[model samples]
Target: MSGAVWDAGRCWRCEADDVPVIWLGPVQTQEHGAGPFAACEPCIRRLEQLVETHHMQADRSA
Candidate 1:
């Protein structure tokens, strides 16, 4: 699906342009469920931060 074009106007987290939306595919886990939504650059960053926090918490617990 590389080089696929996404609908820029549907993106909510960032200004829609030529940039591809992040996390606009199926969810990685069953708990999260499936997703076809689009996210912008800042949202992607926020998601990364959230994942990092979760990982850190997991490590601390371990």
Candidate 2:
């Protein structure tokens, strides 16, 4: 969950540019293959929620 703050960059999820970003980690895509991923604050929060929800569901299933 460690990240580096960026003043301006493109978000991998929403494709937003020229905004504050958090450089999280690497990601893979069919088009670009694999590289570092950056996301805006909102996208980052959304992704964190998704991961938390997924883990909660998994725990319930277990």
Model 1 TM = 0.53
Instruction: Write the residue-wise lDDT of candidate 1 on 16-56 in tens digits.
Output: 66665654565445787665666766677787799899999
Candidate maximizing TM-score: 2
Candidate 2 TM-score versus the reference: 0.78
Number of the top lDDT candidate:
2
Overall local distance difference test of candidate 2:
0.86
Candidate 2 deviant stretches above 4 angstroms:
1-4
Please give the range of 10 consecutive residues that has the lowest summed lDDT in model 2.
Answer: 1-10
**Taking the tens digit of each residue's C-alpha lDDT, what string does model 2 give over 1-62?**
45455668889889998878887888988897989888998998999999999999999999
Alpha-carbon lDDT, every model: 0.65, 0.86
